[model samples]
Each structure stands twice: as structure tokens, then as C-alpha cells.
Target chain A: MTDWTIDSLVTALRTRRISAVEITDDCLARIDRLNPAMRTFITVDADGARRAAKERDSDLAAGRALGPLHGVPMAWKDLCAAPGLPTSCGTRTRDYFVSEMPCTAVARLVAEGAITLGKTNMTELALGPFGDNAHHGHVQNPWRSGHCSGGSSSGSGSAIAAGLALGALGSDTGGSIRLPAACCGIVGLKPTYGRVSRAGAMALSWSNDHLGPMTRTVRDAALMLGIMAGWDAADATTSRRPVPDYLQGIDRGIRGLRVGVPSNYYFDEVDAEVVTAVREAARQLGTLGARVSEVRVPDPVPLGEATGVISRAESVTIHERLLRERPQELQPVVRTRLEFGEHIAAHQYLQALRGRGRLTQEFLRAVFSQVDLLIAPTIPEPAPEIANVTTGGIDEIIKKMGRFSRLTRPFNGLGLPALSLPCGFSTRGLPLALSIVGRPFDEATVLRAGHAYEQAAGWVNRRPAIG
Target chain B: MNPSSTDPGVTAELTRLSDIIERLSRGLGLADEPASFVTVLEEGAPGDD
Candidate 1:
């Protein structure tokens, strides 16, 4: 039961093969056993989880059932607010403040009957790329001890990989969700910016931030996205467009689907193993009938620079008070990054904002004209040892941060949907991931391509040696 | 479906005429771009989930 996906749990619960209590207990037991070691959970609400499960069971007995995720247990990245639980956002600031209202994304799932175990850990202020949090303790890669778990959605990724939760909600600004998902060998979807409401979530960079699901399977990602994505009056940025039933066309396959393997930037300086695995994945997609060919993607370096400008500017605004008052309380990495924003000129920020539209238009016209999606490595390399990333000096840390997140940053600036899923594993047994990036608001095609590749590659079943 | 992914149109107008010319040559009309993120947020635009 602990190993089941949301779909599997739903079927078992609806057929009376499993009780919500049993499912909840399995996850709690695993969390209790692993939290001390993995640091995946920042707060564990076992009692509330059990209570929710019991109520779900009672509803079943009374011939009433909750929506899509009824009886399924999941965890949320601490960045999103959940009532009755503190959303630490992986920092000392407002860690103990429990909001009266859960974030709309969390509330949406709660309305659909997804039982929550508690909040998973994240990078402090959801800023860093490595899952090392100076406040809540770092999340270790479930695949191997003392290895990077990836962040800013670190805990959510480790929890799903270790079977602590079936699925979790993770927010992505740059590579938060996708990197963690890649490192942990799961599926992560960073839906188009504004696809999911960010009403109650902790703000990082308002323009760059995105919210989506991290789950064990592609369809599970679809199931969660189906419920979480929609127009929200609470979030003015959310799309007025209707959400699609992502799962409907998911298995339709990629027979004639065009997949571009970038001839330039996407593969540049990427580790040989990562490049090989993703290339192999593109080959697998071709075998699955996708029309695969080489194509030149617009250089994302300029877009990446714009991402930094907007993110730094907006991040400073979000943390202005906390940074001004509690300067000494934040981690050096967090503090340094925020302070850098103060130096960005208003005109420079405005210039970056202006560049976003042009860059997005250029990217769409140039690349998407030939291909429905592009396939590339999610992270340039597999998870480095935890000791290596954490012990570096500030300059070294900054370098590592930029390099690690470089590949995923441009998409955030472009506000395009990108999906990262397991493609293969490194010789050292760390997970390698393939990213399927699609046109703005085209998460369905991204997920469909990923599903086709994942099914043919058969990498989804190989969970890490954690549980 | 979510309308060209919210260009956050406060800066929606191209700052330079040349930028529009570049876009036009690239085959993307002004109409190809969705309205700014602030505008065009009308809920339930066809194909309601």
C-alpha cells in the first residue's frame, strides 16, 4: 500500500480492497522511520492524516466518495500553505505561522479528497538548487546516502522516491520541481507559469514562480494537474483558459509527434553520461514512432540572463522585510542571493521583463515551428555527493548553483511548460532525467512525449534503494 | 490552452519598432501573442475542464 500510486490506491480503495486508514498508516510508518534519516518531512501530522483517512472510510461506508484522489495519501512541499500545518518554506522566517487558509492549490487537492501526511522540507526560501537547507536540515538523496536530493522542492522528491508519499505538490521557479524530480527518479511537471494558482504559496519571484505536481508516474502527474490547474479568482495571473483532461490524450502515443533533439545549447557542456542517456531517450521516443530529428533551439543564454534579472528583482521584493530585519537569520547563500537584487536597476528589471515576451516569441517561432516538443537533459549531471556541494565556499556555491540550474532557467523566463522524468541511471546508480519542453500551455504534449518515452524506456519501475 | 502563457503585459508593447519588425519577419504576428497577463483573464475560455 505504501508503494502504490494515486491511481492504484484509488482503485483499491473504491473496490474495498484497501482502507484509507491502512494506506495512511503505511505512509506514516514509513515517514516516521525515514524522516530522521532522510529529512524529507519538516512536519508530520500523523493524527490529522489518520483522521482524514477515517473520515474518508466513513464516507465510503455511507456511500459517499470524495473526488479524484479520495483515500490517496500525499505530501506537499512546504512552500504551499496548508491549514492547521505550518508551511516552513524551509526557512526560519514565518516557519511557525500557520495560515487560516490553505493555498488554493492545496485546497483544490483537499477538495478532491487527497489526504496529506504533512509538509515536506524544501530549500530555505525555496531558493537553492541543492536540497541542502541550513534551517530544516538537508534532504538526502533516497537513491544513495550523502548525495544531493536536488531542490528547492527537495523533500517532496525524496519522499516520493522513498515511498513516503504517493505524490506531492512542488513549486518551480527555475528548476525546483524538475531538478528534484530528476535527482530522485520520478516525474515532475512545471506547468506553464500561471497554469496553477499561487494564491497562498510563498512567493519567490512572482513572475518566475510556477506550481505543479511531483509524482511517481506520468499519469499520476496528469491526475494531479487535472485537479490543480484552473482559473482562480484568487490569483489574477492564472489563465482564463479551461484546463484540459491531461490523461485523456496521454496514452494516445507519439506516433507522428515531432520531437526535437537540440543540436546546440541543450547538449552543450552537459555531462557525457547525461547527454548519452537523454540521447538514448530521444532514440527510444523515435522507436515509439515520434518523428525525431536535430533542430537548433534559440540560444537560451539571453533568456537565462533575463530569468536571473527578474527573479532577483522579484525575490528581493518578496523578502524585503525579512531580509531587512532578520538579515543574520538567513543562510549565507539565501542572504547573498537576495542582496544581489538590490543592485539591479529598475530600468534593467524592466528591460528583462520586456525581453521575456520577445524571447518567448522568438523561441516559439524558431523551434516550435518544426517540432511539437524538444527533448533534453533535465540536469547537466547526475546528483553530486552531498559533501561536495555543501562544503564549497560562497563563490563556489554560486558557480554550482548557476551551472546546476542553467538548463532549466530559460523555460521559466519563457513561461513554458516543461516535464522531467526518469530516462536512465548513471554508472554510480544516480538517476538521469529527460526534459520534454513544449509550447506555452502545452503540458499535455510534454507529458505525452514523456509517457511514451518512459513506457518504452521502462525506467519508471526502478525505484531507489531507499525504503 | 491557457493563452500563450501570460506575457505579463505591463511591458506588453514592444519597446522598439525594430522588435516588432523582427517578430513579424519571424512570422509571429502581434495577434499570435496572447493579451498581457493582467488583461484577458476572463475565466472559462472555451473547452472548460
Candidate 2:
């Protein structure tokens, strides 16, 4: 029962096989049983969830119009405002901070009749890639104890993996969504910049920040993304383009779709097992009728460096007040991380932005014209022991942090839609992933390719040994 | 900018950005372009590209 995906739960609820209250109670019970070990949730409003479930059941009985996610139990990363719950962001600074209003993304989900379980934990201020929270407890990877559930959307990833929640909303500045999705063996989608509104979410890097869905299956991601992606008056950056029915074409097989295999950069320094898994994922796509071709992508070095410039500068600007007013309240890693961005000059930050345009142009000309989708590894290595990486001094930890997001951040700079789903598992049992990237505003293509690969690889059905 | 004003972590990051800035400046010719980060929209105007 706990292992059921969001789609299955929704089907059961609609058919009266299970009531919404029963599903909500089961999720609450699982969170109660496993959350102590997993630490995936910052708050669990079991009573509120039960109440909402009852309302949903009554609405169904009354023949009320149902949303696609009707009565689905899910959680939001603590960075998003959840009205009653405190958006702590895994920092001591906001330990008791409660949002007066709900964020646009969560509001849309609630409109669709999804019941909130509670807010999950995250890296402080969404700063670090590894989900080590000095203020809150660690979000443990359900695959193995003592291993990291890649972060800033740490708890969202862990909860989905551990079956504590059906799906979760996570924001990505760099690789916050994909890294965790990859590490925890779930499906994570980082839509093109401006595809999803960020009205009520904490701002990390305004230019780079994106809200996305992390779920157990690609179809669930599609359903959640369809609900969340659209124009919002609150967020000026959201696209005006009409939201496509992502699930309508989701089952469209990738026959004759051009798949690009990068000739350089994405695989550099990647672990052998990860490379094999990604390559095998591409091969599986080939089996599904995708035309695979090797192509040279724009050098990611400048793109990555440019991301650092823009993200750091923007973070410093956003947190300047907090840093000055109460720096000590933040996790040391997060504090130092934000502080490092203070020196980035206006000219350098601008240079990155200008380069972003040039690089996006070059990427479109060089890659997208040749292929419908590009397949790459989401991360270089499997989840490392939290004890080892988080302890090797700040400098060492920072260096390792760079590696965790090396592959994913470049796409954020390009504003391309990218998806990370479990492709295989390492010998030590951690999940490895394949990233499928598509042109701007073309997430449907990326999701379609991912769905085909997911069906072929058959990794969506593998549950972690825990809970 | 003297590197000694900040701690090693800050200095290290500054050094990295400096290298990247130098490369981006040289590799991508944007001398004529203004460096803009966020895409600003006029009131009541949609901001999709």
C-alpha cells in the first residue's frame, strides 16, 4: 500500500477501491513509522490531512468536479510557503517562521485537490548540493542509512523514495531537484526557466531558480508539471505560452526521434558505472527507435562558470540583509557559501548573463537543430557517505559540492528543460541516473523520451530496501 | 582587488570567477552587449520569449 505511486493512488480513489481518507491515513502512518529514521519531513499535519481527506471524500460523493490530482497526498519542500507551516528552509533563522499565504505552485496543486502532507526539509536557503542541514536533522537516503539524499530538495526526494509521500514540489537553482531525484532513484523534472511560477518560493538565484515536481514515476511528474506550469500574475518571469497537455503526448513512442549523445564535457570525470548506465539508457532509447547520434555540445566550462557568477552574485544580493543582521543563525556552510558571492563584481555577473544568451544561441545552433533530445548523466558519482564529504573542511566540501551539480547546472544556465530518472543502481546499491535535455519550451519532448526510456529500463518499479 | 581581504573560501571563489570572467570575456565576444541577468517585463506585459 505504501509503495503505490501517485497514479495508482488516484485510480484507487476514483474507483472507490480506497477512500481519500484511507490513503491519507496510510501516508500519515508511514510517515510516523519511517520519518524518525528518514527525517524526511519537517512537519506532519496528520489531523489537517485527515480533515482535508474527509472533505475531498465528501466532495466526490456530492459529484463535485475533480481535478487530476484529486485527493493525492503530497508534500512541499520547506522553501515554498505553505500558509500555516513554517518555511524553515533547513535553517535556524526561520525555525518559527510561518507563511501568511500559500505559494503559487502549492496553491495550484491544492486547487487540483491534492492534500498537503506537510513541508519536507531542505538545505539551508537551498545553498548546498548535499542535503546536510546543520540546523535540522539530516534527510537520509532511503536506499541506505548514513548516505545522503541529494539536496536542497532533500526531504522531497527522500520522502518519494521512502514512500512517505506520493510526490513533492522542489525548486532548483542549480541541481537541487535533479541531484536528489538522481541520488534517491526517483523522477525529477527541471522545466525550462520561466515554465513554472516561483511566486511563493524562496528565491535563491532569481535568474536560475525554477520550481519543478519530483515524483516516483515520469507520468506523475508529467501530471504534476501540467498542473504547476502556466502563466501567473505574481511571477513576471513565467512564460505566456499556453501550457500543453503534457500527458496527452506522454505515451508517444520515441520512434525516429533524434537523440544526441554528447561527444564531450558531460561525461568527463563521471564514474564508470554511471557512464555505463547512461549509455545503456541511450541504447535502450535506440531500441525504442530513437536515432542516436554523437554531437559536440557547447563547452560546458564557461556555462558552469557563468552559472557560478550569476547564482553567487544573485544569492549575495538576496541574502545580504540576513547575512548582515544575523549571520550566525545560518549553517556555517550556507553562510560561507553566500558570503563567497559578495565579491562578484557587477561586470562579471553581467558577463555571465551576456554569455548566457550567446551560449544559448550556440547550443541551439549546434545541438538542438541536430537532435530532438540529448541524453547525459545527471551526476558524476553515486551518493557518497554523508560523514565523509560533509566533514572534510569547508574548502574540501565546497569542491565536492561542485562535482555533485557539475552536469545539471549548465542546463539551468541554458534555461533548457531537463529530466533525471533512475537508470540503474551501483554495486553498493545507490541509484544512478540519466538526464534527458530538450530545447526551451519543449519539455514534452524531454518527458516523452524519458517515459520511453523509463518503460524500457524498468527501474521505476524498484523500491528502496528501506520502509 | 586584493585577495587577502577575505578568507580562503571567499578568495578561492573570487579566483574561480575571475578566471571564468576572463575566459567568457575572451571566448565570447560580448564587448558591445550589456550584461543583463533578469528579464524584466513591463507592467501588464507577458514575459515569455
Candidate 3:
């Protein structure tokens, strides 16, 4: 039961080999055993989970039709608003703030019959790259207890890796979801901007923020995305285009596909071990009949800087009132970082917006013209020790912490879909991941490539030692 | 009214802008001391003939 994937768990539930109550209890027990040391969850509603499980069991017995995620237990990042739960946004200011309504993503997942397990911890205001928050204790990586679980969806990644929950929802603004997944060795998809509705999720950057799924495998991620993706009237930015059947093309191999590898920027200053894992994954893709070729990405620095400018300007606008009223309520590091946004001139923000469109077009023409998918390292290095990070030195901290998302933020700027999958373990025993980015609104290709790689490497079979 | 007739108003607005910018600079973590803020305001303020 502990080793079950989302697919296997669903099969077991249908066969009555395990009752929903039993599955819920097992997960609860695991959480009890592992969560104290791991600090993965900010809140765990054990009674609510068990009650939902019992209701699901009754529904099953009554021969009622089930949704795709029926009987599956899941959790969400604390930044997501879950009714009656404190959506703290990883800050002391909102410590007593209970959301009046559930986030649209959370509501959709719940409607699909997934039982809510709890909310996972995150960095303050979902701002930092590392997962430590003074509001809630630091969330530790499941693979190595002392290391960081990359932010700001740290708890979601740690919980899923530790088997505290089967799957979870995470928000990615500059690789928040993918970074933690890479560190924890799991699958995280940061859907194209507006691919998934951001209606009820806390806002970080209106332009760069994305809502996506974190799961144990690419297939599981696809299933979660299928349920989560769709246009919402509440969010005007959401595309009115149709959402694809992500699970429909799982068997589609990477044969005859063009896989682009960027020659510059992404590879520079990358840790040697990460480079080895990514190179090995590319070789594996080649063996699977993928037409791998070198493709040049525009100097990522300009794109990254533009993304920074836009994100900071937007974030400052979002938190202006809070920053003015309760400045001290935020973590000192997060406060200092947010304050930097005030320096962004209005013209500079406008220029970055214009540059974003030009860069996106250039990237699409250069990479997609040659390949169906672009592959790169999800992070430049393995998770660092929590104690080693110094938040006081903002520039140094941003440089080190920002490296994980350098390859990711550009895509967000362009609103392209990307998936991060665990390829191999790092030299330090932490997980190493590679991202397969696809053209805008072409998540199917990204998922197919990721599924093919998962089949070949079988890295998803490895689980952290939790209980 | 001719736009050039608003020059005196523009000058008064500039003074207000300088005062607001000085206050905002402090809030943005530039300087806490009044003298330091006045120095920044002088440097940033548009020059007069």
C-alpha cells in the first residue's frame, strides 16, 4: 500500500483490496510518524479526511458514478485557499485568516472526488526559493532530513515525497512547484500561463504566476492537470481554448520527435553532477529514437531580468497595502525582497512587458522550429543545507536561489508549458530532475516526452524512507 | 486655457512631488534619517533655472 502509485491506488480501491477508510488511515498514520520531523504540513485535518473517505466508501457501495480522482487523497500548498483552513500565505500577518471559500483548483479537485488531506507549508508569501519560513517551521526534504525542500511549495513536495499524501497542488511563480519537486524527486508540471485558472490562489505575480500539479509520476500529473485545467470566467487571462486529454496520449512514445538542447546560459555554472544526470537523460532520449539537436536560447539573462522586473512590479502592487500597513509582519528577507519592487520604474516595467512578447516570439521560432520539446536541467544544483543560506545578503541569496529557476522563469515569461521529472539522484543523494518544455499550449507533447522518459528511467519507483 | 499658462502650477506640483518622493524613498528602505532623505530629494529633484 505504501508503494502504490496513483494508478495502482485507484485500481486497488476499485477492487476493494483496500478500503478508502484504510487508505486514509494509512496516510494519516504515515503523516503522524513522519510529519513531526519533516514539518511538511502546516495543517492536517485528520477527522475531515476520514469522514470524506467514509462518504466516498458509501458512495462506492451505493453504485454511484465516480469522478476521475474518486477516493484519492490529496493535499494543496498553503497558498491555496481552502474553506475553514487558514490560508496563511506563509506569513504572520494572515495567521488568523481563514479563507471564506476554496480556491477554484481546490474546489475542482475536491469535486473530482479527491479527499483533501491538508495544506502543506511554503515560503513566506511564496517569494523565496528555499523553503524555510519563520511563520511555519522549515519544511525538510524527505530524501535527506537536513536539506531544504526547495520553495515555496516546499511542503507539497515534501509531503508527496514522504507519502503523507498521494498527490498535491502547487503554485509556480518562477519554479516554485518544479524546484521543490526536483529537490524531493517527484513530478511537477508548471502549466502554461492561464492553462490552469488562478482564481482563488494567492497572487504573487499576475504575469509570471502559474498553478499546476505535483505528483509521483508524469501520468499522475497528467490526470491532475486534466481535472485542474480549463477556462474560468473569474480569471479573464484563462484561455478559452480546449483542454486536451493529457492521459489519452500516455502511450505515445518520443519516436520521431525533435528534442532541442540549449547550448548556452542554461549549462553555464551548473553543478557537474546535475550536468551528468541531464546528459544521461538526453542520451536515454536519443536511444528512444528522439532526434536530439543543439538549439540556442536567447541569452537567458535578459529574459530573466525582464521576468524579474515584471514579477517584482506586480508583486509589489499586490502586496502594497500589506507592505505599508504591516511591513514587520513579513519575514525580514521576504520584506526586503518585496521592497525592491518599489524601485521598478513604470517605464521599465512597460519595457519589460514589450521585451517579453519579442523574446517569446524569438524563443518559439528558434526552439520549436527545430524541435517538439526543449530539455534542460530543472535546477543547477542539489538542495543545499538550510543553515548555509543567508537571506540578509539579498543579491547573493537571489543568485544562488535563483539558479534553480533560471531555465524555468523564461518559459513563464513566454507562457509556455514545462514539466520537471526526476531523472536521477545527485552525488549528495538528493534528487536531480530535468525539465521538458514545450511550445505554448502544447502540454500534450511535454507530457508525452516526460512519460516516455519515466518509462525508460523508472526513477519514480524510488521513494523516500519515511516510515 | 493655454498649457503654458499652467507653468506656476507645474512648479508647485514639482515641490509636492519632491516631498512625496522623499517620503516614499524612506518607505522603500533608501534612508531613515531626515538629512539623508533631504539629500536624496535634492539630487533627484528637477533643477530650477
Q: Which candidate is the best by TM-score?
A: 2
What would the per-residue lDDT of candidate 2 be over residues A326-373, giving only the tens digit for each residue?
Answer: 988877778888877777777788787777767766777678668888
Off by over 4 Å in 1: A94-100, B1-49
Ranking by TM-score: 2, 1, 3
- What is the full ranking by lDDT, best candidate first? 2, 1, 3
Among incorrect, acceptable, medium and high, the docking class of model 3 is: incorrect
For model 3, state the Cα shift of residue A150 in Å. 0.5
Model 3: CA > 4 A from native: A94-101, B1-49
Name every residue pair that clashes in candidate 1. none
Model 2: share of real contacts kept: 0.35
Q: Relative to the unseen true structure, what is the C-alpha lDDT of residue A239 in candidate 2, on a scale of 0 to 100?
A: 76
Residue A159 shift from truth in candidate 2, angstroms: 0.4
Cα deviation at A246, candidate 2, in Å, is 0.4
User: In candidate 2, which residue pairs get closer than 3 Å at backbone N, Cα or C atoms, i.e. clash?
Assistant: none
How good is the docking of model 1, by CAPRI class? incorrect
List residue ranges in candidate 2 displaced over 4 A: A95-101, B1-4, B26-49
Can you give the lDDT of residue A156 in candidate 2? Answer: 98
